[model samples]
Each structure stands twice: as structure tokens, then as C-alpha cells.
Target chain A: MRDWRYWLAEQRGTLIALAIFALMFTIYISNHPAGLTTNVAQTAANKGTLLALVAMAQTLVVITAGIDLSVGAILVLTNCIASMVVTGNAFETTLGVVFVLFVGALCGALNGLIVIYGRLQPIVATIGTGAIFFGIALILRPLPGGTVNETLADAMTGKVFGIVPASLLMLLAIVLVVWLPFCSSVIGRAAYAAGSSETAAYMSGMPIRRGKFAAYTLGGLLASIGGLFLTFFTYSGQASSATASTYTLLSIAAVVLGGVSLFGGRGSAIGAIFGAFAFRAIGDLMFVFDFDALWQPLFQGVILLLAVSIGALGLWRVRNRLEWFG
Target chain B: MSDTTMGRLSERMPRFIRRIEPPVAISFACIILLLLFGGLYSSAFLSADYLLQQLKVASFLGVIATGMMLVILLGQIDLSVPWVVAAGAMMACAATAYGPAATLAAVPIGILCGMLIGLINGIGVAYLRIPSMIVTLATNAVAQGLMVVYTGGFSPRDFATEEMRYLATGSLIPGVPNALIIWAIVGAGMVFVLTRTTFGRAVYGIGNRERAAYLSGVNTRRVVMIAFIAAGGLSAFGGVLLAGYASKAAQGMGDAYLLPAIAAVVLGGTSILGGRGSYLGTVAGVILITLLLSILSVLQMPEAGRQIIYGVVIIAMLLLYGRSPTNQ
Candidate 1:
């Protein structure tokens, strides 16, 4: 009833990302002494979930032909906020969580305002905002210590029904709530159009600016969501510049590995999530194999190079040299 | 604030000195204002020694930002600067551990290591047609990973050699530090290359439009590859200078320079989008940033406050002239 080729083409990036994750996860779990247990899966899922959320955030901006270097800072900022506010009683915790998410969205909205209305490049604007966000976080937690609601943190970090990782479930809920709705919305399609060709999108009278604004704002929100999760996982927050920068860099890598074109206008958040998982799996493979922790960075980097390089393999098939620019 | 005033200045200025674009002129003005601003706090801020100290420090960033400007001119970027810089300092220092011969050859060897990373970056961006951003990013991570593996998470025990130390800290010409001389040399070379050489023209050409440049038979790929390689080597050289200044290489030493280097480049009026900018603008930019950082520190601002100021200043400076908005 349906054209399988079209479906395959549409889902190619996601399928490839999923395959990569599955392959790497298999190798990782196989190498571990404990084999494939719920505990191991839960740990892996819990760790991978942070990067997945950030990568998802990056995906929205990338789809709009812009990059957000501030996502990590936003996450860190939200984490710091959550650490301070997400305490007291259950109602208080819930209120704090809402406040944190709001702050995240507010940060994203600021980024959107600067880029869309101030008419600045996204890269530099985000870099500026990133520094601001990190500074704010530093002010909030200068010494790297703050507390979140312990019960909430434990539950969020724990397994669901003694099997599935609760963090992963929350991540899925986010994808459903944040990404799917935005991906199918008029503004989201406008974002894709803008990314593919901004001039065309604008010429067609599409709401390109509004779409981009939504993307940047959503990107911030997602980063904050990731930040909240970080708070839950750690039960604390620290404004480490290293963490901010690392997450930002790795998120870009994850987006690329997820099959999103850095050139913009292509790919999905789910693909990015899988890409993040694959990246996490690649990093953890060293631990399972008993390699020194020192070797992890090099190992992760080499695997990332290989993964991103594979995408470049498609260029060789092009007959015209001009398409390389395209 | 307005291009109309800028147009008048260029029109009024002599053709020979026209390289000082409006943004560059504005940057120079900012430097003067910054000095005055600092003078209001402490008379020592305008003192020769203090100014000289700032100049010496700016030299390191000046050298590194030179490489970044080259890449930015090509409409690409090299995020690998930070780690490549560490690799340079680390490799140079590590080479000294191998006996006298390696010690003597350390500087070149360190730079060569960076160039090697640049080679991979160049190949990926050129032959493989990968986006410069992602490729440089991958190389940066790989460089960091390799460095970590080499050091095993500890700072290198090998101290910076006397040559590097002298180059960084010693003043051969009585008043000027060797680092300043090196920057002057590099800066002069950059100016000449950008204004006089065909390679420079090709960089601008490719950056403006890669396809058009390719069709014009400019060997666009080779030019891009060389730019990345040069950027890598220069970044490493900057790292070498930094190690010399500090007497040893520490883990993540390069991290501090990345943002400052980029900010300096953009502040100098070079378009982040590429194809337009000048060396003098960058020189003014380096000094401006150095003074700004100095004044901020002298004020005893907290790190977070300083960071906020730094970010704000960059955005404000860019807003002044770096207004090359993306497509409609």
C-alpha cells in the first residue's frame, strides 16, 4: 500500500543512528562482565539521557539553519536553579521544577530575540549568551554545591517498574511533548524551510522569523529540561565551565552523528537522541574493556571521527564537483 | 554606529592607508578610550611598563588570533585551536625529555605536531568536503584525548626550554619582549600575505563563494586545506609561547585562549562570515581585549562578573559593525 523506498529515504538517518547505537551498545554490554542486565541498561540509559536531551535541543536550532553554543550553559544554569529551588515539600519541588523550565525557556527566548530581531549571527550571539548564562550559574553556585529534592531525584534517576530506566522514559515523554509537536507544527515546517533555503522560505511568505524564534526558544527549553534532569541525576549542581563547554561540543557531535546536516534543514531529534546514545556507548566501551580511564577521550574521539566520516562517504558518489558545495 | 560616517572616512582617507577599515579605526578608538577609562581608575594604567605588559600578553593571543582570522577569512573556523595549542606546548615540552638533540628541535617538533593535526583537519574539510566546524571539532577532541593519554591526567613534568622561555619572557632588543617581536613578525607576514600574495586573494575568493571560486580555477580546496593547517600550526605556536611564559605546560592550558582569541578577531572588525578584514584591525582588537581584561581584573571583579562583562563587551562590539545578517 505504501512506497517502501520513500519511507526508507525519510527514515534513513534515524535508522542509521539506531543501528549505530544498537551495534555499539551490543559491543559494550558484551564486553562487560555483568552482561545485559537491567542495572547496566539503567546506568547506561541514565547517563545517555543527558546528552540525548541536549542533542535534541541542538536539533531544533540546526533544523533552522542556526547553531546554539549556549545550550550547555542553559543546562548548567537550569541545573543550578533546580539545585537551589527543587527542595522543600512535593508541591514546592513541583513549583521549582516549573520555574526552572520557565527560566530555560526564558533563556532560549533571549537567544531568539537577539538572533531574530537584533539581526545577529546565531553563533556569536549564543556564545555571548552562553557566557552570560554560565556567569549567572556561577553566581548561583560558585562553589559547586546545592541540593535538589532527594526523593524526586532518586525516583527520576531510578528504574521504572524495576526494569526500564525512569530517565529514559522521561526523555521519551519530552520527545513526544516537545519535539513531535514542534516538528509537525506550521512553525516547525517553516523552520525546515528556512534552514533548507532561507531566501526561498521568506520569499514564499512563510513565517520564517517566528519559526526560527520558536526553534531557538525550544532549544533553550530543551537544554533546561536536560539541566533539570542533570539536577535529578546528581541531586546537586555546579557551574563548571568545563562541563558547559564539553556538553556544547559533544551535543554538536551527537547531532552530526544522529544524521542531522550541520548545513541545516535535515534530520530529526530522535536521530540525534540515538546519536547521543551511540556516542555515550562509544565512550563507555573503554570502561567495559578495562582500558585506563585516560584512554577514554582518545577512544571516544577516534570513534566519533569514524562515525562522522562515514556520512562523508556519500559525497564520493557525486558526479559533479559543484554538488560538494551544495 | 552608522555606515554613512564610515563611508565618508574611507572616502576622505588616502588610498594607501585605506586598509584601516571603519571597524579597525573604531577598534583603535576603543583602545584609546579603554586606556583613558583605565586611567581614571589608576594613573599606572597608562604607564609605559603596564602598557608594555599588556602588549606582551596580547602578542600570544595576537599570534593565535592570526590563525583564527585566516580561517575566519575563508569563512570556516578551527575549534581545534585550544587542544592543538596544548598539544604544541605539551609535545614541545615532551620532546625536551628525549635528550639534547630533541630539546633543540622541540619548538619545530611541537609546531609540527599541531600542523599534523591541521593536516587531518585540512584533509577532512578539503578532500572529504566535511564542514570545517565539525571536522575541526573532531580533531580538537582527538587532540585532547591524545594529550590526556600522553599525560595520564597529570601535568607534564618537563619544563619549558630556555629558548621558549626566552622567546616568551626575555627582551632581546632592550625595550621589547621577544614575544612581541614574534607577533610583529607574524603580524607583518599576515599583512603582506593578505594584501600582496595570491594565496591571500584566493582565501578571500573562496570565502566569498566557494563554488564561484572553484569555477574560477582557484584550487579552492587546496587553499582551504592550507588555511586550516596554518591555523593549527599557529595555534600550537601560541601554545608554545604560553608554556614558555608559564615555564611549563598544564592540562587544558589552551582552553582559556579560545574564546578570547575569537572575541579579539571579531572585535577587530573582521566579518565572522568571512572575506573581509584587515591585520591592523586585529592588532587593535588584540590590544583592546587585553586592556579590557586588564582593567576588569584591576577592578577586582569576580570571575563571574568578569565573564559577564567579557560576554557583554563582545556582543556590543559586534553589534557596532559585525552586522552581516544571514539570508532573508
Candidate 2:
């Protein structure tokens, strides 16, 4: 019980966000019992999984005090590349997926290299690269429509167990395989150190440049995974797949709300996952209420503001309490 | 010893060339490149009419860039410019509809609205002790939200009057645009303000060392507020001209300006981390960007290619300037 309490205390923000999610989910179920069925569950699972992948990518960069505005563009570019390469054959499709992921990593490495070697500010540099990536995506797939193999899409989106969605299974696998090691490793600690104080970290021999480069490269890799998942869910790759640039901002908000400081040096992969789920639940709740699309931007902005402020206040209070003890 | 002294003098000459080279030579190179492309691609590109049109388009961005430059000079930023521009245009359009008197009233109202937002940003940063980036970003969101609620994503119809049209499309000289003239006047005025005024000196001082300036009896907060207000007013002016040019304001029109304005400031040899800059450099930067766009248009490049190149050029410029420690 004591151990559990300590764990819960460490993740208070995530716990609170999860509690809100549960409340929202209960309301959603009460409003639309039909939406509680298998189909809706699977749909939510698929969409949430994809969004979580993108959020994870964003989280990696944000944890290092850098932001990758190019995520959406990279997603589009990867999706387009996948569409061009995958021609419905099972073997070909697998190859295409691998190719897309590789491309995504390559693109991310370019951004990381520029940031590290070129010594460009992350925001400005990424915005520029984002524009270039977006342009390339447009050139590759000039319009909205490319087909994905139905079988592959179905396999990814379908149930893996009696009731568990395949997407959930994929999410679990990814969490176990990629995130666990990455978050606990020396490299990750270096990322935290760099974010806290680059100059100090450099003085401490933390390999600051390498850490930033790795973070960005990882961000790109995660975004590509997101693109692949998005393709499976939609069963298509469109040029305008990532039209919502505001998603990047929302992802940042989610990270911050999950108790991740915008200044970086403090956050968790688990917290980011919870933040993603919380955001998804909020959107779902709004839909259940039948709010118009016009209200989306306003609602998102307000929620983001509220969430960030609450998180900041909570952190301040915690620090104040700790100071009292000292 | 004399030979060593002569060698050192020659070495310093190259260093001097390198120092003066970037702003003047780069802009000249870009202009020459644009002229070359224009000469080769299209006969119409060299005409005074084409040049004037490009100048007019450049003016809208130039005005905002000038204000942005001031904020940059103060070692801060205002991300709220986009929505402020939208709000300014919306307010102007709203005023224009009620009556001619109302339309005239909009000028001050637009300036005041911008000033109010700027003051809020300044207070948030200076007194409340918030980071400028986050504060301005939040204000941008609020402004954008308000703009959407008020305008409903459509251009307000009130700004279609003869006066508005004159402001947008009319020429002061037979071929030269009125907007270009306005841009020149604003640029000259700002240059004078920055160099001649005590407030300008204080801005540079504050940028150099806020703590030192504060100790030296400079009203740092007020100066910062004035800088933001000036930026806001300038952005509003850009918005007014944009409405005049298009005959209406649209959603996200201001978004496209964000990068270009910042780029112009950077390209003008202004440091992103602040402390050293010149209006002349910004003027050159604006011309370079405008010329680049004009050249791309003349080349008949696709929108995607143009966008890609735009980002690349800006990044390249930043990298080049950022590496030169002297700029810092």
C-alpha cells in the first residue's frame, strides 16, 4: 500500500488525468450505449493508438526542450511514400512499410543533424524543414487518395483477443519494446540533463549534442510509426492526411498537462500516454455533446490553457512544500 | 615588426570585408540573382509595373517586419502579431460599415486595440515575470479564438469602400504604389526613432543588459511595453493594408506572415538571441525575400517548391548569421 501510494504520488498528474478520462468515458457510455459496442471500441482503439504514436514522437522531442513542428509533414510524407511503394501485395506491402519507417528515421536524422551540427534553434529550424517536408509530400501525392491493402488494414485494426483490439496489442508491444528501455537508459538521463541546462550538462560531459540528435531522430521514427498506423485506420494515404497542424500544439499541451514542463527536464513516457488518452477522451466527450466543429479550436485552446495552468500551479505548490521541508 | 604590422592590416581588411559583406553583399547578390532570373524568364518581370506590384506586396510584410524588428531589438518576441493583425482588420472593417466617421474612428481603434494587447504582453513578461514566448503564444491563441468568434471565418464586407480600395490598390505616382510609399515613410520614421530618441537608446541598453539598465534608472518595463505596443500597431497597419489589398480579411492570412517577418529580421542581420541589429539590414532582408518570391513566380515554380525553398533559405540565413559570433 505504501509502495502504491508512492507510485501514485509520483504520477499525480497522470492519475488525475486518468480519473478525468474515466469520468468522461462513463458519460460517453451513458449518452450512447451503442458507442460502447465492439465496433466503436475498435474504432477508438485504432484512432487513439495512432494519435498516441504521434504524441510519443512529440514527447521525445519535448523532453529534450526541443519541438519538432515537422511531425505532421513527416507523417504525410511517410504515408505518401508508403502509398507509392505498397501495391496491395502482402510481401510488397511489408517492404513498403519498412521503407516508410526508414525514410521517416532518415528525415528525422536530417533535422537532428541540422540542429546539432548546424547549431540552429530547434523551433525555427524544424519549421523550415517542416515546410520542405510538406512540399515534398504534396509533390509525391498531389491529391487526396491512395489505397492501402484491405487485408493489412483489417489485420491491424481487428481484435487480437476475445475483446481486445489489435491496436491495443500493438500499443502494448511498442511500449514494452521501445519506450521502456529508452526512458530508463543513460541516454535518456542525458536528455533530461541536457534539457535542464545544456551548458551545465556539457560541462558535466553528458554528450549534449548526441542526446539532442538522438531525441529528434527518435521523434522522427515515432512519427513514421504514427503515419503507418494512420494509414491502417483510414485504409488510405492522402496528401492532406496531416492537414491539422494544430495537432502538434495539442500534443505539446498534452505533454505539458501530463506534468511535463515546457522547459523540459521533467516528464515521463507513461505521463505522455495518459495525456494522449485524456485528450482523446475530451474530444470524444465533446462529440457526445454534439458541439459544432467551429467550437473545436476555441475548446482546444481553452482546455490547453487550463491544463497547463493547473499543472504549473501544482508543480509550484509541490516545490513550495519541498522548500518548507528543506 | 613593420612587415608583421602590414600583414595584420591586410588580415583586418578581410575581417572588415567579412563583417560588412553579409548584409550588403548578400542582399546585392540576391537582387542580382532575381534580376538575372527575371531577365531570362520573362520580359514583363523587368517592367516598372511588375516591380511596383512586388514592392506593394513587400510593403505589407515590410511594415510588420519593422515592428517585429523593434521587439527583436528589445530581445523579446510577440507571437500575437498574426491574430492581432486579424483583429485589427476585423475592427477596421466593422468600423467602415457603420459610417464614414466610423471608418475614420477605426484607425485609432485599431492602433489602440493593438496597443492594449501589447501592453498585456509587456505586463505579462515584465511585471508578472512570465516568459515572453509562452505569454505571447497564449495571447495569440486567445486573439485567434476571438477573431474566429467575431468574424466567423469570413471577410467582413464593410471594408470594400472607395477609400479602402484606394489605400490598398491605388498608386501615389502613376506607376509606384501608395503602399510602397507608406512603407518607406514608416521605415524612415522608425530608423529615426531607433537612432535619435532616448527611448531607442534605452531599448538597446535594456537588450544589452536588463539588470544593468534597471539599476541605471531606465524604465525597462515601460520601454518593453512601448516596444510591444509599437510592434502591435505596426502589425495592425499591415492588417489594414492587407484588407485593402484583398478587399477582405480571411482566416489564417496572418499565419503566412509569421515566418517571413521573423526571417526578414534575422536576414537583416538581427540576432535571434538579441542585442545587435539595424533597420537597414531588415530593409535589405525584406527586399531579398520579396525578390526571391518574385523570382520564383517568374520561374513558374509550383507552390510546393516555392514553400520548400523559402524555408530552406531562411534556415540557411539563420545558420550563416548564427555562426558569426560578432552578430551576437
Best by TM-score: 1
lDDT of 2 at B271: 76
Which structure among the candidates has the greatest DockQ? 1
Per residue, candidate 1 scores C-alpha lDDT tens digits across A202-298 of 8999899899999998998999989999999888899988889889988998998898987789999999999999999988987887889988778
Stretches of candidate 2 off by over 4 Å are A1-10, A32-35, A241-244, A310-326, B1-21, B40-44, B107-138, B151-159, B173-175, B205-222, B324-328
Question: How much of the real interface does each model capture, measured as fnat?
Answer: 0.64, 0.35
User: What is each candidate's DockQ, to 2 decimals?
Assistant: 0.66, 0.31
Tens-digit lDDT track of model 2 for A24-103? 66787678758588887887777677777777888788778877778888888887777677556889988988888898
Q: Cα deviation in Å at residue B267, candidate 1?
A: 0.8
What are the TM values for chain B, all candidates? Answer: 0.95, 0.88
User: Residue B30, candidate 2: how far off, in angstroms?
Assistant: 2.1
lDDT of 1 by residue, B221-283 (tens): 899989988999999999999999999998779987887888888988888878888888889
Give the 10-residue window scoring lowest on summed lDDT in candidate 1 chain A.
A299-308
Q: Write the per-residue lDDT of candidate 2 for residues B1-328, one digit (tens) a residue.
A: 1435545555657676645535545666777778777778778878887777788899999999998999888777777788888777767777777777887676566667777778777776665445566567667766777777666655555454455567768986887788888899999999898899989888888777777777788888788888888888889888878877888766676877877888888888787766678887888888888888777776688877876887788788878764423211
